[model samples]
Target: MEFRAKTVAESRVETVHIIRPTDLNDAGRLFGGVLMQWIDEVAALVAKRHSQMNVTTASVDNLRFLQGAFQRDVIVIIGRVTHVGNTSMEVKVETYVEHTNGKRDLINRAFLTEIGLGDDNRPAILPRLILETEEDRKEWERAEMRRNLRAKQRKEGFHFYGE
Candidate 1:
C-alpha cells in the first residue's frame, strides 16, 4: 500500500485550559475523568492531523496520573504521534500544570492508539512517521515496545501491528 510520510512535529498539538470549579470532583481536585476526556481529544486531533482522515481511539494504555491539579491552575496538554503502523498510530498525550513562572509540571501521561477510518468505516491506510530527532527516535522505540507488550497481552492477534 502506498503511504506518505509525516514528521513528528507535523501533527503535534498543544492546548491549554483553566481548571474551573466544574472540572473538580467532590474532593475539590480536578477530576480524572475530565482530564482523560481532554487528553483523548488531543490524541484524536493528532492522529487526524497526521493521517488527514477521520480517526478513532482504539485503545488507551499507560495512563498515569503523577500529580493532582487544583482549581484555577492552568493546564497544558500536548499530544504527538510517536509511532505509526499500517492503519494505526500511537499518540502520547501529556498533561502539565503551567505555573506563573512559566514552569510546567507533568500531571498526567497516556499513550493512545488511534486508527484512521476509511470509506465504509474500515481501517484506513495511514502515513508513516518520520523520526527526525533523537528524542523522536526514542519515543518511537518506546512505542514499539509498548505495542509489542500489548500484542503479547492479546496473544498476537493483530495483523497490522506489533510484529
Candidate 2:
C-alpha cells in the first residue's frame, strides 16, 4: 500500500478558548488538567489530519506549565505534526494565554505521540511528514531524538504503571 506524504502545514491546528470561573482553581488560575485536555484534543486533531486515520494517544512528554492564566483570559492552543513513523506520529502542542490587554504569554508546551489504527483497531501505517521550512526540519530532528529515547526506555522495561 502507498500513502501520500503530507506537509506539516496540512496538519497544523489551532484553537482558542476563554477561561471561565469554573475552569479556575482555588487560586483563581486555570487548572492544569483543563489545559492538558485541550492539548490532547488539539494534538489528536493534528495526528488524524496528518495520517487520515483513526488515532489514539500513546503518551505525552515534557508537559511543562510555564505560566498561569486567570479567568476570562483567552487560551490559545496550537498543534502541529513534527514527525511520523510507519504507524505513529509526534505532535507538538503549545498553549498561550491572551490577556485583556492583548498580550499573549506562553503557558505550557508538550509533545504527544499518537498511534494510527486501522478499521480492525490494529496499528496502521501513517503517511510521511514533509518538512517545508527550517523550523519544521529542526522540530522533526528533535522528535526523532525523543522517539529513539522512548524506544530505548521501552526496551529497558520502563513501565509507567508503577508495578
The CA root-mean-square deviation of candidate 1, after full C-alpha superposition on the true structure, stands at 3.4
For model 2, residues 1-163, the per-residue Cα lDDT tens digits are 4569999999899999999988998889998888889999999999988888889998899999998998888999999999888898899999998777878889899999899988899989999888899999999999989988987888899965532
Clashes of 2: 0
lDDT for 51 (candidate 2): 83
What lDDT is reached at residue 78 by model 2? Answer: 94
Q: Name the TM-score of candidate 2.
A: 0.93
lDDT for each residue of candidate 1 in 60-93, tens digit (9 for 90 to 100): 9989999999999999999999999989999999
TM-scores, all candidates, are: 0.93, 0.93
- Taking the candidates one at a time, how many backbone clashes does each contain? 0, 0
Error of 2 at 5 (Å): 0.9
As for candidate 2, its clashing pairs are none
What is the alpha-carbon lDDT for the whole of candidate 1? 0.94
Please name the candidate that would achieve the greatest lDDT relative to the true structure.
Answer: 1
Error of 1 at 155 (Å): 1.5
